[model samples]
Target: MTDQWVSFSKVGDAELVSLTGEIDLANSGEIGKAIVGRIKESGKVLIDLTTVSFLDSAGVRLLDALVGDLLGHGARTRLVVGERGAARMTLTLCAFREDVLTTDLERAAADLK
Candidate 1:
């Protein structure tokens, strides 16, 4: 669809990155770059997927890779998902086992503590 969109904001000690539009092969690297750039600066990242309309395999791969990079750097990552569909499904299918991603911000923050 339209070019992929990602916006960033801060919530307490967490950095929230809100992603929109379709995430596919063409834009997944951009997404990764934006996120990694933020993590390099702050080392704490949260991905808010409340508005993501679609997600493809490349998107999932990017997310998975980012999670690994974040964890390897001793940074924290969280995922806040709204509603349920392909984006959530793809996340579950690709990134569920890492224990680095979470749907609840409070819980994630507590765990980080």
Candidate 2:
């Protein structure tokens, strides 16, 4: 089993959700819930995947759902994938929209404004 983890912090008007470890089938739902929960509470969210070491198809699905859910709620959301992060490969393979992708948490938060 992958040891997945997630942490959340407030940055200005956006909530930064930092994910670490491997995001796979076992934890993808929880990860999605945590992110959506915060978005429900804060309205603006920035997901930082810099510390994440692995991301599977499940992670891609979670991100896609997150964007759709956020759009339905009329909230802004951003995704940050560090240049050297492991999550990059999965994200790139999934072809997530460039508009929602950033390289740093700070940039993601700034753009959420």
On TM-score, the candidate that comes out on top is 2
* lDDT tens per residue, model 2, 1-113: 22248887788978778888888898999877766665675688888888888888898898888877886787788889977668887888778887888888878888888
TM-score for all predictions? 0.80, 0.88
Work out candidate 1's RMSD over C-alphas. Answer: 2.8
lDDT of each: 0.73, 0.80
Q: Give me the displacement of residue 59 in model 2, in angstroms.
A: 0.9
Clashing pairs in 1: none
lDDT of 1: 0.73
Residue 110 displacement (Å), model 1: 4.5
Q: Which tens-of-lDDT digit does each residue in 1-113 have in candidate 1?
A: 22348877787777777788788898898788877776675667787766778899898787778767777887777776644766777887764654665556566666655
